[model samples]
Target: MSNSNPHRFSLESFRRKLASVDALPQLCVLGVIAGVITGCLMTLFRMLLKLGAMFFMPDNDPEAFEQLTPMLRSALPLLAVTLIGGWLALHSGGSRHQIGIAHVIERLTYQQGRFPIRNWISQWWIGLVSVLGGLSAGREGPAIHLGAAASSGLGTALKLPHNSLRVLVACGTAAGISASFNTPLAGVIFAMEVVMMEYTTVGFIPVILASFMGSVISQSVFGFDPPFQKAGVEMDSFIHLPWIAASALLIGLLAGGFVRLARSASRLDILPFALRLGLVGVAVGLTAFWYPEVQGMGYDSMRLTLEGNVAVDVLMAIAIGKLILTAGAVACRVPVSIIGPILVAGGAAGALCGMVGNMLLPGVHTDPALYALIGMAAMMAAVLQAPMAALMALLELTHNPQLMLPSMLAVVVACLTARQLCGCDGFFISVTRYGMHPLQQPLMQALSRISVPAVMERNLTRTRRRLSYEQASALLDANPEWIIIERSSDDKPALAMNAAHLARWLLEHTADDVLIDAEGMFDLLEIPGERLELAPIHLQATLSEAYQCLNENPVDALYVVHGRRPDKPRISGIITRSAIERYYRYEDQSTTKNR
Candidate 1:
């Protein structure tokens, strides 16, 4: 009607066009493909690693491995595995491929959520060979990262909504785990608890589709049988809760110890990555010499335990060995998941604990299988610091209702003890320490984020306190939304005399003992309570964020950092809420344009 050009609509149209890059059907198709590809990769990783171990022994015969010369069998596996691993690692899928779950969390929060293709490839390369070469590591880490990366790539190609993309990433991660362990429900929970940190309907949709699809893919490739899963009793016994809780506490403490030691050892600058990992391989080789059952993810060892052959003391020794091996393995950062090894280690510990508990009780006592089950849940819960994840894992792995109460009971104690003894909660601990906020920030969470530096306004406006009433009114009219105050030159605080308070101060007009400090300056000259100081204490950002402070106490302009003495508050800027709102509007528009 007004002869306005239709070009204005072009901007929104362009955004829409950019966003329509990837189609939904195509994304789903690619997602399924990615899951299948990731599944095959994991299977190959398992197969190759086992082959490496088999070859390292020089004899196809299980009994013949030790009979072969120690120099040939033991030392050779160590040397050959590490060197080849180092070589493969040197050219690993690509340089960026080492990115793990931690990096994923970071990119999601700060960047446009683009995980590098190189990183996923490199992780697969590193994780697969390292595992096959007999490094004391697990495959779940690479599986999760790769799966998530695959989803991210799909989302990019599809140009899906940011939220949808995030969900896809979570789904990919869950699918990897489900496919890896054949724990479907556990996979779902792991995604919700570990990655998404929220179990909302929106998040659940894609994760369910992705996880089930991955499971379907894995089943077709690996077989319908559950990888390490077993069916057990209804555990209808309520009496076991107390004992389970006790065992969980003990296991939690032990798991926590291993986690702390592992992190510390990994930080050792004296030992290089290659040597450290090789040494761990040597350690694992030595472990195999005794508990040959402990080699290769320990699933077979678990099977051996359920069959009731391992001695009590031997089980204990193997359990400790597995913990140390896992710690040493992860210390090298040779690309593996702590989750798998943790499960294995927990099972080993549980078996050991069960055997010992039986021996100590002697007549009417807890079954070894029962204790073993409880131990698994407890340790997993403790080490992972995720009670729900551990519980779900137990349910999926055992399919035993009898173990549920014990598992939940054990999980509670384990999680509590781990948190108290070890400052950080599981998986994302390192990420939290580095300072980027996560979706699920645990207890001491507030300690890290509850600071002036953590949350504050970004942009701000300036003002002076010496202006006349008319000038002040003009400034006021200019900045309707922001409040103005004064600042101090030295170690003094920034003072903000709120416009509302100042107006009332003018009406009240009498100087009294009512002068308050805004920054570090005394506003006692003649202002009333209405003209009280406003501004945050040692804070950063715009007047907008400080408005809450103004509204809460009743005040005006803010005193800010003087140019010379950055720490000291000086009268540098004045702001009214209206001006701040307008600025915020402009800023919001600018940010949208840039995006």
Candidate 2:
């Protein structure tokens, strides 16, 4: 058994510290562990994708879906959908089908970041097949899911506290993005801006460390090549700023439509799962039949757009076709990844805009590559409502600080257009609309960071339900704050009474000159003191959990215990509802004062 002593440097002690808000050192340690685990898993995940691509894709190129024959292009998605549907059918219950970034966010917000092993296993195969079969899906989404699950599993196996598990999940999220894209800074920003939805010094250090380690591991295996080629492109003149902003407005509108379409499509639960998937297969296959550029992640197409090689008409076609098809697939809930496709579509749209600008104003010297880069950032920011993460990604991917000025303009414009003009919530937020919002209340977030042991009252004594008058008098000598009346049977609940109340009763009986047998038994339940019903709660639980327990149970206060077993619980402390309220009230005051 692990040492439970708080003073000792042990796993239990480490977990206890993590339950507090200032456990930066401990969280950073866990961040490194999560990073290492996520990096290995992501490497394996990429290798599996590479291996699967080689089996069917020509020359082992994962993005060579356009090179396949039209027959194969149409048939691949059908085969993939049949397989994915069959795999899902095999485990047809609960949330086993929930896979990808939205699922990760759901677990973090509602389930204390405890990922289900079943969903993790499903994502591995489904993600592989989706890309290999040319489903227009991105690998990064599945990669994030895998990384977060791996870290959550690690925390679960170690039996770490829930607060620590939450941080581990965030670490894995950053590591996943870092490993998949080879962009550590962007990964860290994405974890904070998109997934965690909150940023702090305590959170940033660990996520940064995890993201760096993930990039290190990925680079060690993949030779440090970025997914996109270094553009070496810069804005030629300030005159193009107006055009760039105009393009951002259009991209923002497109992003809003994409989100709305996908969210509206998600409500089509009236259709059977198999039928919905089949429809998606047919739609993608038909689109691929004409425009093979729409197949797979379309990164190759994105590369061509960035190189300014694609014709304006073709770019427009690809931008529109990809946006519609991807939105459709997402609506069907086919587990198809959307990020890569969104980038490809946005880049195509931007390239088209640049071509149009060149035609309309010959002296402006418009560069399609620069526009493509800007569009990628703007669309991402608009769709995800994460401008900081998108901007970081744009800078890291291009390795050009010159793009920051234009990219910022585009990102802000796009986000404003999508959020205010189009009335669009972020894509992930739209999908997870039914879940409890992570930032719903300030007090709940505050309480979640504190453990029961931090606020629990330990000044109490446990005793049998019935005690001799002399025995009670002796117990009062210790001056405990409260007295616990132990249950006679396991089925009966434990009771607690204020020690002062028992002491007052003892004094009154002795002063009244009442005849009392020295060995007479005093039934604590029958005494004049008010007795409170107590329920058992684990020591690792947070104040939020204790509050939840009090709300769910009829008991007045919770008794903290050390072990999981119901029959042999080791009582450690007590926490009342008022204590929880008082703690948060004080926290609120402290925060106000600090400001």
Candidate 3:
């Protein structure tokens, strides 16, 4: 125990450093670590998908579901869902079935980013099966879940503080997006705009580093080529702006309807998992029978749409089919990836609009591909409610800066239409509404950034409920600000007494000859000092957690402790409600001054 103290103290010191708002160097190192971890995992995930495709897909093309016979295409989703449903039924306890970006957000918001190992494992095989089974899903959602779980697992193994763990989760999320899409800047923006839901200098540095590392690692394996071919198509005239805005409005309505459908479907969660997934299989199977282009991620369909090779009617059919099928899959809680399908559908819709425009104005020779690209960005922004991320993804995917102006216009219109006209929050937020809070309050956000140790009062000492006069005197000789009255039994709560109050009581008692001989024992609780009921809090807790603890427990202060044993935990420090308020007040003032 004595030897462990030094090591534990060093670790606690490290945690304290991370609690600071300016721990950029430490966080950047963590970011790099997270990126490398997530990147490697993402590579493995993609490789596995490719390997799976080799066995089932003709020509080893993941998107070659179109080449499969209609009967085979129809059967594939049913077979895949059967396996998935059976697997989920075996593990039908707890939240093991909950997987993907929505799970990531729930963990970050409610659990401080600690991911469960069971769900992480479940996501690997389930995600693989969903895409391989031609379930109108993307690999990106599963990749994000895997990345976040891996990074959070690393932090857990290292026993990092919760506040730092939150940052690491953000790092992993960005790295997942970066590795999956090979878009580092977009990855960082998505992590901030979608997952973390806030941006800060401290967060940006680590997320950026993680995203860069993820992209670098992914590029090394998959090469430096972007996913979509550069269409070399650009908008030639401003006369198309009104048409673009009109298309955005339509896309927004579709996105909002998609969200609404998914939310309404979530209500069916009370049904058996197998029943819901089986229905999803039937819907997807029937759709794939008619339009195999809607199966899988639909990247092949997207490519065709962008090249204007597909007929206008085909584009419209693919768009509507993908949207409804994907939404139905989501409603059935099939764990299908929505991002890839959303992009594919959006591009198709945009291409259909572009074809209509060309027909309407036969004199103009604008390419449908331009509208497809802009539509992809606009739809993504509307569905995710992340305009900056969508724009970044557009810029990176297309490697074109000129489209930024027009894409921005379409994105804003789509986002406004979806949010105002359709009344839909982002998809992830809406789906996980039961377990999520916006956490948008400024004071709460401010408090979450700081760990308890950063604001806790260390000028304190712990003693038993009863102490000899000399022991009490000796304890006060240290000039501690507070005295912790250790509970006599496991069931009783510990308490805190102000040192000044104890000192005054001692002085009065001594003057009255109550303890002149210094032989009597003093019951600290019985003394005339204000005693605050104390709840035990872990040393790694953030100030936000401390604030929550104070609110949830009928206590005025908390005794910070370490170790797993509640009966014999090591009390490290004391934090009063007043102390937390004072710290936040100082921080608020400092921020105001800086502003």
Per-residue accuracy of model 3 over 393-498 as CA lDDT, tens digit each = 9898878887898888999999999999999888888543344445545666677777777778888988998777778888888899999888878788888899
| Order of models, best TM-score first | 3, 2, 1
- Write one digit per residue (lDDT tens) for candidate 2, span 356-379: 889989977898888898999999
Q: List per-prediction Cα lDDT, in the order shown.
A: 0.59, 0.84, 0.85
lDDT of 2: 0.84
lDDT of 1 by residue, 1-595 (tens): 5988787546333323222222244335444655665566556655654565575444432223334444444553385356545554666532122456666666654443568776666675556554554444567777788788777786667543343456567778878888878887788888877766666544565566677777777777667654345555435456656656767777888888878866774366467566765776787677666655444455655655666767765577557876777776656554455666677677767776666666765764666777776777788788867788888888778766667776777788888888887654774555554453355543211111122222223243345444444444455554343344444443343444445555555445433333434432333234554343454432222232334445665554433332346643443344444444454465457546967
lDDT of 1: 0.59
Best candidate according to TM-score: 3
Model 3 poorest 10 in a row by lDDT: 431-440
> Where does candidate 2 stray beyond 4 Å?
1-7, 93-96, 431-436, 477-479, 486-493, 511-519, 526-531, 552-555, 564-568, 593-595
Which scores greater on TM-score, model 1 or model 3? 3
Clashes of each: 54, 0, 0
lDDT, candidate 3, equals: 0.85
lDDT of 3 at 5: 62
**Can you give the TM-score per candidate against the true fold?**
0.65, 0.92, 0.94
